[model samples]
Target: MGELNQIPLKTDVLIVGGGCTGVGIFRDLALHGVDCLLIDAKDFASQTSSASSKMLHGGIRYLESFDFALVKEALHEKNLWLKLAPNLCQELPFYLPVYWESKYPFLWMTKVALKTYDFLSGFQNSAHKILRAKETILKLPGIKKEGLKGAGVYYDAIVDDAKLTLECLYDSLLEPNANAFNYTKIDKVEAFGDSYKAELTNTLTGEKNSIIAKKVVFATGPFSDDLLMNLGFSWKNRLLPTKGSHLWIRKNSLDIPYPLVLQTFDGRIIFVIPQRDAILVGTTEIQAKGDFFDLKCSEEEIDYLLKNLQEFFPAAGVSRKDILSTFAGIRPLVKKEGGNAHNTSREHQVFRPGKNLYVIFGGKYTTFRVMGREISSEIVHGFGGTYNPGTTLQALRQPSVFPTFTPWELSEQAVLESLSHEKVRTFSDLIHRRMGLLSLSNWNHKKSFVDFFTGMLDDMSRYIIVNKAEITKFWP
Candidate 1:
């Protein structure tokens, strides 16, 4: 909630990213009474964090790689979040459809996998079921009936990732010593005498400031390799940086009651999830070749998702025209020699490029809390502070004004509350992330639904700066 001009000149810890991981660390350290400042080059969760497939699950497929530890760790976190942030995350059933020609065609194999998945969660997850082929068809209308062999029903969770991250950051700000700014970029960092001086520039208003910290942590996800290289740090390219994209279509497009996991021709799994008014489909894994920031879904990736969707739901009649919008994000998977992006480990690695600097990358969103603890505990201990990993087990103290995955009537008071408390600095920040409106299609739908806010520009200007140009971008 602090303005860019009000950033403190010094802190005990300075975190250089505002994604889930960074915010998670901020909350953990702040809870332990550490003075911390977090900054982001853009709005919180505007990049990879917001562009996720919106699922928080123990990677069932990771079992193939014998990643039981990672899967178990992630499953525990997934279940914990369901209890900690029920308003922002929910448990959902996911169906793995198997065909006669499928790799794991036998129902027993899938049943065993589901049982193992449940056991990994210490049997905390929802009960698993083995649906007969007829039951699978009955549950999933319009599903491809050819060679159908049944489905394994298991439970995972779907989350409002951006809102959850924002809530975490907000919870951290409850500490008087904790502060954060979005649209603030760290231009340079100089280490001097057991401390680091970081120069930051406000991208929106072009304001400059400097902060001194005893320790600096970079929770920069996919941007790690480029940022480190540009900062003149002696860093190897540790990131595989795979791009995953998703598509949002009308919920009526596919009539499945639960999320369907489809195996692509190339042996990758794609999820078709129905979320309220929209059906979410996605995720193509390809090595990122260009700029990873603010990435868009490529035509080829879109085609790949569509092909898989059509293959799984031959009678669904899903097409390019059905896509309401698309989003893409780069996953910062740690590079493993001779390992493809899909097979790379989701385990995160922490590096100390200097005595006072730490960098973490290559973890899934589900395990962000544990990742935060891994680094924060070290940094907090280095500062001579007692770190209690259990402090973060409590529920988030700050919740988003507009909670996601639920419907509520928009109001002037809600907009004002978001602007005053949720760090709504820009028009795009308000619409695209905080409000969970991803694209123009969402705006159009909302506009037709009701006159949500009257004198909207005038109303917003009372809380934060707004102009006709920004308003026109949405309405025009």
Candidate 2:
């Protein structure tokens, strides 16, 4: 829906893909006063970035693998964002309940883990505590009580993934000579002198144009493998495309009092997080089978999540009927020689196929800002600009119009303003990401979702095309 009237003839830097990594570098170079243009094949952060588990935290399970450095860096970033964007995300205490039959049974194992986790954060987190069996049951009333020995309480942040990435782009656009576009794709790329010539296309309108860029970076995330190879770059498959899916269940289905961490029989972990009006559950890891660009939650993954969830909370009686909606995404783990997707390191790799071309992929969502530092620094220095690493440490300047959480009003004035400024080109962009309506539930108590938008649809037509069918289907 984002149709650009004028295309750039040339730029100092051209970034392909507008996910976290892409936007991270975009903001970095923009802050250093370099001319940069970022373009995405679709809406920014609409793919794997939006489909994450939605938690910004150090991987607690990675400790078993002795990935201390990654865990430490992620913990620092986790706590930093909790300070940076208070409106976009919130910190919550995660309860990891341990049973007698568990591989790492309570008190000692959880005690040592929580101590190390707190130490990694330098005690910036809400202090981790090891609770006894009685205390665990008292705090988590709906948890499985059979053979429960104790629990480990730690802290992490829950974020609005799409909104966070969008805010990053907005912050970069506030800088001088900074630009970005969505629904724009690079159909082909060719070498040209010190710079490269990129053939860009408008995916929606089929418009075509070519531009010369001094430097090109592909921060395509999971789609990196397929994209670079298709664009005729000197590329090889470096990604292990793994599918992970989630289900949003009605809140009352589980009545969870706190966010939880559950370990499964298959050596994977499931996160049960409770958001306003819904219980967010998910993530079945398997080899990705279909199109990487578009992924849907498979029945097997859905059943897998519900089954593991039921095992942890047998009294809740959760099933497919309780699901409000479902979403799935792929994880672009850099393929290792012998390890599987679950065991691959959460670190990233930057590839330089040509003197001016860089390809980056395979990093945790929490470490995006740091992941692009090397590329941004090298690119900025190439343009004779002093890249200040501290610039990104500051809080983002632009925030989404709608507060991502619930208990917020939806107004015509706000929606119209967002449409004009937030790069919202479609109806779904406004309703899903900007407005933060993940499910079909009505926000206003006095009106149905459709009734609330009854007259608004006509006004919305002035900016983007819309009809009652779009509003009608959301309600009934």
Candidate 3:
């Protein structure tokens, strides 16, 4: 994992971003025997890719907009990944509670939408059912009882977004000619006779280098607009950057066996998902401004989410005190006129600014595989290589060192394995992305995080440079 100093000067393809879409394309091309190099400004999936709502469902709400085609494609990819990486993803039941004042007053409307959702998945998803108010309350304790008619129980997949992206990158690296570097940024690019030369800088060491590739691809997602303009690529802003935020609350804050879909008074849908020993609630669609990197949840957005939670679970007494941590991500929605961010389509768009440059933007996390194949097929064919789309359907070659959503003792061997194989560059990367420790509060539930990491600092340093100050910041 000497990615910083040992980067090649030339490759067949150079991918500019290491988000889910970029890593997905890297795997697809690597599987087809393409010499590829992928670079990211920070840890892979540290941005919008990891900041998803963490659900892999056909947008049931999208059906209202009649986006059947996008729903169908996403459903297929969602179901496929459920099979491809069973450990990283699982099918879960999502409960949509209905009230007397609900937009869909009757349960039949939800039933119709859910039936259509399953149909879009070719009936591959588990069947959905309508649960009576009593059953719904029993399933989700402490829920608001007034005006509750019934709930719609539907099946959707839940994914470990960051780990899934990292695993895809890991699988691509198994190919002999594929390589990737994190904390590496492409500073500038110059076209040279059907090829492009990129100036890359290692953000950590402040080292500079250059890479020449026959084709350059920008899978920059929400950062597409600023990145393209900064690089002087003559590209207009194509993204309607919508900021969505989530909160991780203590699991005891609200006891729900499964996820609850709450329809806010503003007609937006909020998901209260349970995962990794905490309750995950999110998502407000607002026009995003300022720097988009490493975004955090705004107080207004947090209050909005908590207000909805209070509305749904009036007796739960959930407040800011119950919130363990909060995260925000920008959605790179393809801009459309008139409608608000919530109504904008989730469809992806690809642009070829020049003969040798490809830019893809505005797609959901669940449909990344298909979005990536669209670019990979053309790039592989351009190189005179036979692109078999089925090649990427295979299982990932390397799994993460830590098991997702399972209880395990954090042993010395586990730390060594993560540092050695998971491309862990810093203590934050090890804790947040690779090890899946999202909330600081969860650290107290387990053993002393500080004590454990302090003991392993010497060994962790042998793999990658990390200091006690960095590890102390995460201490409870």
Candidate 4:
């Protein structure tokens, strides 16, 4: 599937993005014995899929809007993944500190909301509790105590987002009818007698090929609006793109003993999560401009997050100096009339421009497994196959060689297995996306990635085009 020249001449379904949604559908359909080919312009989960806030929890704030269904579905999926792939997910107690001057300022009000979250999950979530200012201060040592009421504690989860998506893909390919590629792109798709003749180009190599598919799906997310129009479909723009950014600060930079829900002065919530070796903080919502893919966290966003973060933990003295890295991506919320980005719902919408073409957009990362079921069911039924929703409830048939969340020795054998088995076609694909190493700093190796692999250049060349200079470009 990595080789573009061996592209299948025909497929039952052709997917144009390798994010969680695409891979989720691939697995669902493959379980029904359907033939599918998934292609991405970059590595799997390299876009918005990898750029999530790394949590798999029900949006507690959405409860205010009475979005109980979304919360329940997401919480169920969150708990399911924790059971299905325990290695990639960790459940943690999140602390939402309440301020007397803030909305939901009282502990009783916050406690009620937290209880609602637990109730929605059929009590699957751990029990909720309320801690007084003294108890809260004991857990989060440097918290600002002025007008502090209490903290509402509830359960949620964290995950290696990119690794989960990649494993979904690897599991799908365990079926003979499922195939996928990383750097190949479907450039132009057109109707050809009840089907689509998709023109695919190797974005890195400029190698061209065409394949006919009975159904062509667009899991392009924010790129859906522009992609459909470019492909000659009379597609109306249905997306409200909002840019959200996150920062990875050095662990122990602040007194955050547990993940936090920071209620901002502007009436928005900012999450402060502690992951391995770092604290993951995010997320600002504003209208996106310019490019939609691989966005950089803006200075305004950084200033906003840091200012609010400092307000909650005044004694911690957190600043830009503690920041290790930053990332951003557009949220492809399905547009509603007169609705702005902040108020828009995180629900996905599907558009059928032709008889068999489908365009899917929106929804959060937590509910990706359920997002593709509507289409997968239809596609499977067309093939006279039974689609079982329980099929995906099983554990993933394949797991990535290297494990995240825990530290392990980086070996030459693991590196080669990643290139061959993980569908890694580029050095960036291997290090940044597939291996879940955002940078050399994330690697556990004492020496540089280049120094660790210098002896295996000859063996590594069989899978990826790596040299001393190229290796340095990734690490340095």
Candidate 5:
């Protein structure tokens, strides 16, 4: 499955995009013992999919809209994720600090939401903890105390999104007939009889090739509409991309009395999540137009986030100077009639526009596996009574990194040690998304970190000398 420049290879399934959705499909198909080929226009997970808020929790906020099904599915999948990749996914306790001046001022109603979340999660992992106002202040001394009420604490999980995506791709590559190449773009796609043909070009090298497959799946997320249009389909309005931005600030001791879900002035929600030595304050949801790849935190967004951060933690030292990094990502949401981006539905869609063509639209990071299974089921049904869908369920427990290793056996530290400096670079790249070390260490990213990483790279250079600048460029 390596470099077929002149050869036109046939496959059972051809997937475009190496994002989470594409890799999820590949995992499902490979488990079913199918012939598949996955191609990405860039390195795997080097897009919006990997650049997520890194929360693997069931969206508790969705309960306000009574989206029980999405909540339930996400909650179940969250547990499955914990059991399958414990090395990468971890349970995190979050706090919801209440303010008397806020619209949702009633602590009782917040308790109701927390209890609902607990019920949805089967009351797992300290489902909800209600604390007095004084207790809340003790936990977060920086919190505004004037109109402060009690707080509701709950459990959710955070994950290393890039690590998970890479492991998924690695697992898929291990399967026979499953191959992935970065910088490969499916330029044009068309139905040929009952099958489909696509012209693929390497975006990096400008090399072109054609591939044919019985089934072709489009998992391009926000860019799905553009790709589908190239395939002669007019499926506009399938998704409206919503841009979300987050800022990473070097943590001070005063930053987190604990993980906080601070209330925004506009009734929106944001998490002041505490990493070991840093705090992540995120997420502004606005309808995004033009380019999805060209996402950066606007001055307006940074100001808005800072104002909100000041409202809750006035003396937390959260200025532009403390910011270590800033990132933005787009959520592929199904186009709705009229509402703010945050109010848009978070449900997923799987549809077939033609015989053997599948397109997945609209889903959150937490429910990817379930989405994969559902789409795989649809693909199996289109195979005309040949393929069995149950195999995917059997393969559900398989780890995307090391298939033989159970959740209990896989080690996060082991994975970190295994990476070369050529492989992992930047403080954020190493701890934040690759090793789960952000949660594990407060002593990360000191002068020692650069030296430690440099030492590792020097050792790796003996075997595979890589251009440090080239490899580290993508990290920051």
Candidate 6:
């Protein structure tokens, strides 16, 4: 029935969810020689993981809420990511322009917080800086000078989120016993005595299967509550599900030379990062009600981002008409109720809702490796096993330098001209992923380039989207 692939299989651990947290756990457990199986309902990193602001930093904004612990841990983890995945993550310089009326005008506050972040990071001080306002504007010529008190220059990083997740999956595949399958859903996870069994179905083929494992983990993010609801244990309601939407614009190449995290009029920080040929900006944190897949950039959010960009780059005078693309994702923040949204806690929690089941919640992308390590360590300890505490840290310390891949040298003409023969899966992927063209003139040329590429790829005689309805035959 239902093309059953009903085969008996067993493992030491079974991990659910394929986002940063789950993948982190997958990598850590695999490295420790723990046999495991991991699956995702959709493609890896396609959900909230794909929707991040694309930053790898010590949550510098967390200082407003005084989340020192999260800042320290995330800051340290930032270094780890840059170290292990040099191809996907790199240091990005950030400038904060101080205005006369802004609440965070004092340079001292910025310095103190950065110093603490640097200290906690131990030896990872390459991404920390303090620059004067004039010096900052010199690097960011587009910065608004009206009432400009000065500025503070600092360091952080920009990352390719989807690629990073893919790297984790690739690393996990290194373990012969470990496997990751996309478009596979976990239909059920029921405890049968001291062990648990999972019912898994391949969404593509309508195949049914099951596996037995000694331990099960639920690393689902915003959906953590719904997944736990069936077990009769209510989650702590830790996440507020704040929606963050971003816009990628193709502004004319300005002398403005560095990644910027400018403060908006409403006290929110918006990033104007300069990738190769374009500049990317955005992130509006509006409390959301729908699931992650349906998230999109609204008109209001778009206008808000434009207004903030104008404030910083008055001469640039960016507007909606200038935007090439937009994206949105919901942040799974711990619920703070009436407390300030920016002040919410980012500390993650691990729970045992049922026998041999563990759930992780409220983890940030920056600290995913540590989160994974901690969860795996707990699982091992729970099973009366022991592992080297420094395994994950050591993994991070290892260098992964690729001598051939170079981003700075690649030209837009060369990239598109090369991909002209390739098929288009979606417009977003073309603009955001393929050539990594964004709003920055260096990163993205413009929608014109995208339109040209579309024409270049429109020859469907070379590619096809096959589904069951169109298929006359099936292959096993």
For TM-score, the strongest prediction is 3
Each model's TM-score? 0.97, 0.96, 0.97, 0.97, 0.85, 0.83
User: What would you estimate as the lDDT of candidate 6?
Assistant: 0.69
Sort by lDDT, best first: what order?
3, 1, 4, 2, 5, 6
lDDT of 5: 0.72
Q: Which residues of candidate 2, in runs, are more than 4 Å off?
A: 1-4, 443-447, 473-476
Give a tens-digit lDDT track for model 5, residues 371-449. 7878776666666535554454432232332221122233433434534321232333444444443333334444554
Those runs of model 4 whose alpha carbons end farther than 4 Å from true positions after fitting are 1-5, 439-447
lDDT of 6 by residue, 1-476 (tens): 01112333877888888889898898888778787777777666767888888888887788777777888888877887777778788886677777777778877877776677677677475646676767766776767877876676667778877667756766666666576665577887777778887888876667888888899888888877765665456555656777888887775633466777778788778887766555678688787775666478999999898888776777886777777668888777767568544666778878777777888867788888888988888777776778766776544321112111254433445445323322122333333444444423432333455444444443421332323322212110
Worst 10-residue stretch by lDDT in candidate 5? Answer: 401-410
Residue 433, candidate 3: C-alpha displacement in angstroms: 0.5
lDDT of 1 by residue, 1-476 (tens): 43444888899999999999899899999888888999999999888899888889999999888899999999999999999999988898899999887877899999889999999999999999999999998988789899998999999998888999999998888887788999899999888677888999998899999989899999999998899989889998989989999999877778887888887678888998888678889888988876888998989988999898888888888899889889999998888899788889999999999887899988899999999999889978887888888999999988888878678666778878888888888877887777877542464455542344436777788766777666655665
List per-prediction Cα lDDT, in the order shown.
Answer: 0.87, 0.85, 0.88, 0.86, 0.72, 0.69
List the lowest-lDDT window of 10 residues for candidate 4: 438-447
Which candidate leads in lDDT?
3
- Clashing residue pairs in candidate 5 (N, C-alpha, C atoms within 3 angstroms): 139-257
What is the C-alpha lDDT profile of model 3 across 332-394, one tens digit per residue?
999887756978999999999988799998889999999899999999999888989799889
TM-score for candidate 2, residues paired by index:
0.96
Every candidate's CA RMSD = 1.7, 2.0, 1.4, 1.7, 4.7, 6.3
Q: What's the residue-level lDDT of 12 in candidate 5?
A: 87
Whole-model alpha-carbon lDDT for candidate 1 = 0.87
True-vs-predicted CA distance for residue 324, candidate 4, Å:
0.9
Runs with alpha carbons beyond 4 Å of true place in candidate 3: 1-5, 445-447
> Which digits, one per residue and each the tens of the lDDT, describe model 2 over residues 1-476?
12345778998899999999899888888888888899999888889998999999988999989898999999999999888888888999999989887778657988898889889888988898888889988898878899998899999989889989999899889886788888899988898988899999988778998999999999998888888889887788899888899988888888677899987867778899997777889788897755788688989988899999889889989998888888889888888999787888988899998898899988888999898777899987877778788888989888888877756776879888888889877777788888878543333342556676777887788777778887766555
Question: Which segments of candidate 1 are over 4 A away from where they belong?
Answer: 1-5, 439-454
lDDT of 3 at 126: 90
